[model samples]
Target: MNEIVKTSAFIGAQPYSPDEFEAAIRAVGAERYHDKHPFHKMLHGGQLNKEQVRAWALNRYCYQEAVPRKDAAFMSRVHDRELRREWIHRIHDHDGLGEEGGGIERWLVLTDALGFSREYVTSRRGALPATKFAVEAYVRFVVEQPLVIAVASSLTELFAPAIHRERIAGMLANYDFVDDRVMAYFKRRLAQAPRDSEFALNYIKTNALTRAEQEGCIAAVRFKCDVLWAQLDALHYAYVTPGLVPPGAYRPGQATE
Candidate 1:
């Protein structure tokens, strides 16, 4: 657990080789990713009810809607045309262009299947306060942090496909309400996350040239894991555990269209 919890895993007197650095980054996810969260365990193990699942999907829309804006914020601070060119596609992948559609649209498809009106999902007035805070904190992070560290924060995608696969299988098999159409967001991300993480990982490996920079990058990933884990913590608290659905936030069986 020390390897997982220690903040200084890569902040030693000497910097790690690219391979060691990559290993340390993956270690953060192995230990800290939301895949390990209790809420996700319940989610993927067929333990949550339809109301709880609806709450998860509804709150997640807040995060899903923010991704492209986060990428846009990152790209705004970047001066390198090549970097911006490579990164712009991230926004496209989320926001879509023309009629290609994108992750956000697919996510709304999920909410639609779950019976939420697009306006309700898009308004985000029903998301838990903590969820909105965590999502915006991430957006502000990519906006304020060093570009490489900001890029590194995205390395969480490296560990995403596993959870996506688990979600696709688990939700489909367990929930009559969940089907291939409802899982379209995660299925699409199976392709996009790998592509995006590859670029972000390469950028981090190449650009984080010093021990401090490398450690900072690693910490950024840790921060991102916290961000993701924190959102689930809030969801579990509001919808699973204590079961206080905070005023103005989403509650299961409320007005779903």
Candidate 2:
């Protein structure tokens, strides 16, 4: 174990009340959330042209594609029927029930408007290596981490509504290509993310009884924030300054015609 985990695991070092623990988790979001990333700032500020926007939509599809799989992986380990029942709704929200078409479908709508074919977006053929690595790491984290920490890792959703709101407003105001239909993903997430994050925050507050466990939960959120931030870093590195587009990753003018 690393020194940070060792320090966090030391019981009774700092016992937090439920409110304090919740604050610590929020603090992680405040400090580490990907909204602070430069690429997101550029995206929201209309600094990116159409292809840059397409690159983002394409790369982000990889994360959207992973959401239900990670949720299902977490659900698979739960023995409690009620918890499973509650958690199954997340899968429904992402993968959709029947023909309702959930978040993944809505995200593809954005990519499609950006001129990427559904096949290209879903195939993830254009995703950055760093984007794939970061997203897959999140799936593995949920699959391997203790259940409580796995749930806690999702607390990044607490910060999602603000970013989604920013995205909807910014994209609409800044880009001619963005309309309500193109931004349906963020609009839906405004409601879904809050509902999901509330349940997750309450779950952590109620369940993380020990100081060590609470710290671990905090670390989990921090780790998830890193996962998100890393994706933006990859985007900015490839599409922005010092533009080093890695092998087989999406490049400008490469969108489907």
Candidate 3:
């Protein structure tokens, strides 16, 4: 017991005030979030062709689909009833409640507008390998890491509402195929993201009580950012620049190129 306390003291050395800690967490998103990625710029700027847009939607389906699984993993590890109750909404938000519907369904609405069959998108059989790896890594992180760090990883939501706003407005303004219906996912997220991010931010700020814990939480945000950025990197590599589209992955002209 004495040794545990001594180790904890060492790990928590020079812990920040709550305000300072919150600032530090936000700084991580400012620096590392995927909004900085060029793919997003092209996506929002209407630089991508229909094919490129299709690829983005198809690949992104993997992430949207995985969100609920990661939340479930987090809930599985939580012992607190209140925490579980609070966190379970995240899953329902993605998975939907009965007839009410959900984020995943809305995302598919976007993809359906782009002309994907539900079978192809949900199968995830054509996603960039990196997309699969990154999404799985996120779920695994929540399952394996300390509960607070896993929750902190979700703090990327802190920066998401802005991007969703950009997506809704930019896609509608720029793309001929885009409409309020296709943009429903981002439109819904505009309200939902702020609500969800607030809970995650407060949870981390309150529970990441030690310096090491705080830094780990911040790094988790960076990790999620990397996960997001890497998907774009893979997309750019396979679809945009050299246009090498991986052997089994979707290319603009066909299901796989």
Candidate 4:
């Protein structure tokens, strides 16, 4: 294994206390997730090209689509009606009643404004290899983990509002093609993320009463952060320095620059 992977694996095996795991959750977001990714740094610093920004929106659509599916997996496991009803809203938020609404549709609108065909974006034809792995890992986490831990995994939403705002402001300022309307997805997320994250956090905190359970909750969030971080690493590796674009994915030569 590579040095980074080897080190991370070694660290992953270490035992963690509940408070330590909680700190690790915050640290992972602070240190690992795409918020600190150079791509995001460039985007927030108003340095990304239009194509790069479009690439981000297109790739991110996969993650958006997966959110509700994972939520559904968690929802199916819950026997409580009140919590299930509240959780169902997450699915509705992403899926909507019949398109033209919800996160997926909003993501498509962003891609559409960026000049991508709706079919291409939705089909995920040119998406990066890492994007698929990370997004699928999230869905699998909810599907495989216990309900409490699955709910806690969604806490990445806790770190999303600020990233959403930064991305919106930066994209508007940096890209001539980006307008307020093109970025409706981010606008909705800015408001919705806190509400969703609040619910998940309260659920975790209340339900994870024992120290070990609380630690598992924290680990779930960290795992979620790793999922996001891995995606950025893929993008950075493929589209940035050492540019190893995966086969079957869109390339700058074949795609609009």
Candidate 5:
């Protein structure tokens, strides 16, 4: 029993080797990204009540909104024009050109379909403190980390495609309130994630020549996983447990009507 407890309590101490670093990256994605998170499991299982779902949408918008800015930061750091041009497409993917497109707009379309007022979702007034911290940590990671690490931080995208597929299928099947059109953002993400992840993976595998650089790249993905996991932790604490919802954050009562 003690051994079982110890093994279960272990927190990932496998030192990475340069040759095995790509596998290490895949292993982390297989194990730690939010797709494996219990909240997501419950969400896909349709166990969360309406308020929990709202909390998810509201909090996740913070993440969605930050993607472009972080991509811009990473793009800014790239000295290669071709690389810069390739990466800048991520910003366009999220922010869009005029008014009829972009990830942020698509996310708003999701929230609005879920019954959240456009103004409220855009205001981000009810986002959990942890969501703010986690998302901002990502933006800061891209802005401040070495370029390779910055690129590696986005390896979370590798895991997202599967999760997005599951989420879209599950939500459409189980929720009377949700449908394909409402979840268009994820549909876009399904394609965007793979294309983005492939580019990032190729970049890392090619540029992370030194053992230390490879390890740092892996560590950056781990850091990003922690950021995503922390957001769910805060959501679970505030909304799922003894129900200690934070001040100014969205409340069940507010959405009860």
Candidate 6:
């Protein structure tokens, strides 16, 4: 692990010591993590109404569904037996192993509490175009980018635990509909994200040996931040302030009781 340090010379600089490179990547998360998005701020501050919260969960389901697929695509490209073995846990975490319901299933528990039918949520027909595009772009990014960068892209998990903590606390404090059961998805992630992120950060630091490679890792994290931030931008525009729900996207009142 590296001590956090600010640096502007991430790109086109001389090769960094592993600690400097790690610090540089962590800096990217410090500045660009989607926890800073206003939508999240509103969410954690209890400013959103139930419909708005429902909208967030409905839209976020799309991202949850795409995660396993992206991990699968990344695993398919890796030839290392040990790496593949290690990476397969991510896919299993989302998709589940046999009898255990995984993250996707846990997210649906939240949606179910929100009054959405499993069929409606999974069909994804109501998801915003922006959400669909951003998530698909992430999968495609992992498929198309170098393995190191694709792996590095998942470093967003490095920043996930804090947001999950805030979410759990805020929703529990503010909403009648929220409870321990609905919050299971986030509670699980507090443990899961740190484990996954540690593996990814270690991989990036140990494997990204040159200045150019390290810069690519940083760019990958930036691009992933864009992916996450863009989803909230769409959500906030459609549901929060301007309130321009896209033509085919989920509307606040559409969920079934």
Q: Can you write out model 6's per-residue Cα lDDT over 54-155, one digit (the tens) per residue?
A: 889998999999999999999989999999999999988998999989999999999999999999889988889999999999999889887888999999
Kindly report which residue pairs in candidate 4 clash with one another.
Answer: none
User: Number of clashes in model 5?
Assistant: 0
Show where candidate 4 strays beyond 4 Å: 1-27, 98-100, 253-257
Question: RMSD for each model, in Å, please?
Answer: 3.6, 1.7, 3.5, 5.0, 6.3, 4.5
As a whole number from 0 to 100, the lDDT of residue 61 in candidate 2 is: 95
> What value of lDDT does candidate 3 attain over all alpha carbons?
0.87
What are the runs in model 6 whose C-alpha is more than 4 Å off?
1-13, 255-257
Q: How many residue pairs collide in each prediction?
A: 0, 0, 0, 0, 0, 0
- The residue-by-residue lDDT of candidate 3 on 1-257, one tens digit each, is 01112335445388788889889889988998888899999999999998999999999999999999999999999899999998888888899998968999999998889888888889898899989999999999888888888888898888999888888888889899889998988887888888888998888888878887887787788888988999999999988998888877886777531
* Model 4 Cα lDDT, one tens digit per residue, 1-257: 11111223333454554456556667757766678878779777877666666667778888888888888888778889998989888888888876437888888888888888888888888889789889998888887777788888888888999898888888788778889988898999898899998887777766766555666776777788888888777777777768778898777646633
Question: In terms of TM-score, how similar is model 5 to the real structure?
Answer: 0.89
What lDDT score belongs to each candidate, Candidate 1 first?
0.90, 0.89, 0.87, 0.77, 0.83, 0.90
Q: In angstroms, how far off is 124's CA in candidate 4?
A: 1.0
lDDT, candidate 1, equals 0.90
Q: Score candidate 2 by lDDT.
A: 0.89
Better of 3 and 4 by TM-score: 3
Q: How accurate is candidate 6 locally (lDDT)?
A: 0.90
lDDT of 1 by residue, 1-257 (tens): 01222445445568789999999999999889999999999999899998898899888998988889899999999999999999999988999999989899999999899888899889898899999999999999988888888999999999999999999999998999989988999999999999999988988999988777888888899999999999999999999889999999987778844
